[model samples]
Target: MKNCDFAYYLSNFFTTYLPGHLNVSENTVYSYRDTFTRLLTYFKDERSVPPDKLKFSHFSRDSVEDFLKWLENTSHCGISTRNQRLAAIKSFFRYVQVEQPEYLMLCQSIISIRSKKSPKPTIQYLTGEEMKLLLEQPDTADRNGRRDLALLSLLYDSAARVQEICDLTVRNLRLTSPPVVRLNGKGRKIREVPLSAPCADILRKYMQERKLDRQDRMDEPLFFNSQGRNLTRSGVSFILAKYISKANAVSPHSLPSTITPHCIRYSKAMHLLESGVNLIYIRDFLGHESIETTQIYAKANPEKKRAAISKTCDDSSAPKMPDWNDNPDLMSFLKGL
Candidate 1:
C-alpha cells in the first residue's frame, strides 16, 4: 500500500520542522504530539477509523469540530485544555498549508476554527507575612532541610517556572558580585535573574555543604533526589506542599487555602508589583513573552488600585452646588412635578 500524505507530512513536521526549523522546546513538541495522539484515538474509537487507514481526507472541518466536542463533552477536558488541543491542531494545519498548496482550502478551514472562550482564572499568591511563615517551616539544622530552604528561597526569589528550576545546574549560578541565576525559559530563551542577598546567602551555604562549590561539579543538578537525578516538576510541587502544610498547621488562618510552586511565582510577582516595580521589569523578571501576561499581577492587586485612586483624588478641588432648599424656583418645580 502507498504511504499516506498525512503520515508523510506529520512525520517531517515533528522531526524536522518543530525541533529544527521552529526551535520549540522539547516539552512543547511533546504537548503537540499528545494532541495528535488523542486526535488519532478519537478517530479510532469514536469514528471507527483505524490509525493505519486514516488519511487527510478523513480530517474535514466537521470531523475536527466533532473531535473537539468529544474532548470537552466526553473526555471531560476543561475549556482551556480543549482550546489548547485545538491550538495544536491549528498549528499543524498552518504548517501543512505552507507545505502543500493543494490542500489550502481544507487547511484554512481547520486552522480558522475558533477556540472556545473561558473565564479568566483568579491569580493565587501569598502575602509577605504568609510567605515569611512558609519559608521558616524548613528546619535548617538537618541537611535535607537546608537543601529545602535553598530550593524554596530560590524558587520564590527567581519567579522561575518549576521546570526552569529543575533544569538548573551549578554553572547557571553566578555567586560573585551582582549575583544572578541564568534561567532556561520557554522557547529556549535564556534570562539571567538577579538573586536577592538573602537567597544568595542560603544558596552559598547549601552549595558549600553539598560540596557543589568545587570546580569539577559545574554541570551537576543544583537540586536533586536521593537517586542523584534532577528533580521533576511534581517533585518541586511536593516539596512546596510539604512546607505549606507545616506553615498552615502552625498558623492555619494566615496562609492561602491552596498553594503550589506556581503560586510561589505569583507571590514573587505580586510582591514586586506592591513594591512599585514597573510591569515591564516584572515581565522580564518572570520570563513572560509579553508585558500583557504580567499585567494579571497588577489587575489582581486591590491594594495597588486603592493607592492609585487615593493619589489622584483631591477633596479641596470639589465644586459646591447651590442647595435645593435655597433655590425656591427648583423647589417649586419639584412640587409641581
Candidate 2:
C-alpha cells in the first residue's frame, strides 16, 4: 500500500485527462509538465526523501509554505513562476480530491498557500533611429534580403509573437485598409489584427518582389527559405540577431540585442497603450485570452516608470547607500555567497 495517492492519480490527470478535457495546446501541456517537474524536484530535496516516496499523507500546510519558500529561495523563481507552480499543484489536487478521496485534506490545505504579487519586468524598446537602422540594414535589393525583410517587417508591423508569425500564410494578410492579418494565436484561436499602414506597405513591397501571380497555392507559407521551403522559427531569430548586432553597437547593456521580433511585439503593445488605446482593444488585438496577461504591459510601461524614477533619483535629498567597497561586512557577505 502506498502512503499517498498523487503518484497514480496526478500522473493520469496530466497525461490523459488534461489533454482530453482541457484542450490545451502542446506548448501549454509542456509548460505544465515542467511545473510538475520543478515541484517534484523541490519535494525530494526539501523533504529529504525521493519523489516516489512522497504521498498525499506527507503533504501539509507547512510543507506548502516550504514549497513556496523553496521556489523563491532555493529555485530562484520569480513571483509569477512560483504562483504558476502553486496553480499546477492546486489543479492536481482538485483532480485528486475528485478521484481519490484519501488525499482530500492534503489537497484542501495547499489552497491556503496564497500567491504573492511579482515585480513587473521592464520593457526595452527600440528608438526611431534604431528601428530605421534595422529596417535599412537588410539589403531589400537582394533575393534573401527581400525574404528576410518581409519576415522582420511582418514581426514589427503585426506585433505578432514569433509562433503566431511563423504560422502565417500569404492568405492571412489583407494588403488593404486596416490591412487585416489573420493571427492564429495561442490555444488555437484566431483573430484578425489590423495592420498599420507602414506594415501594409512593407508587406506589399515583399509580395511584389515575390511576383506571386495570386495563383500560388493559398495554403503556401508567406515566408519561405532560400531553398523555397517554409521559413523556420529559429531561422527568423537568427536573421534578427545578425541584423540587430550589425546595425547597433552590440553592447553588453544595450537594447539592440533585446530588440528581436518579440521586441517588435512589445513595441506595438506599448505604443498602443501609450497612445491611449483601450485595454480591451489591445487584448483582442494581441489575441490574449486573459486581460491579466495584457495588464503586465501597464506595469511594464517603461517611459512612465523612467520619467517617474528619473525625477526621484535625481533628488539631492535622497539618501545613498554606502558603496559596497566601503562596507567590509557587505564585501565579506558577497564573497561568502
Q: By lDDT, who's the top model here?
A: 1
Residue-by-residue lDDT tens digits, candidate 1, 1-337: 2448888889999999899889999999999999999999999999998888788888899999999999989999999999999999998899999999888999999998999889999999998988899999999998999999999999999999999999999999998878899999998999999999989999999999999999999999999999999999999999888888888788856576578899999999999999989999999999999888999899999999999889987889866645666657986656654
Model 2 shows how many backbone clashes?
0
Evaluate model 1: give its lDDT. Answer: 0.92
lDDT of 2 by residue, 160-183 (tens): 889887778888888867688898
Worst 10 residues of 2 by lDDT: 248-257
Best by TM-score: 1
TM-scores of all predicted structures:
0.92, 0.72
lDDT against the true structure, per candidate, is: 0.92, 0.77
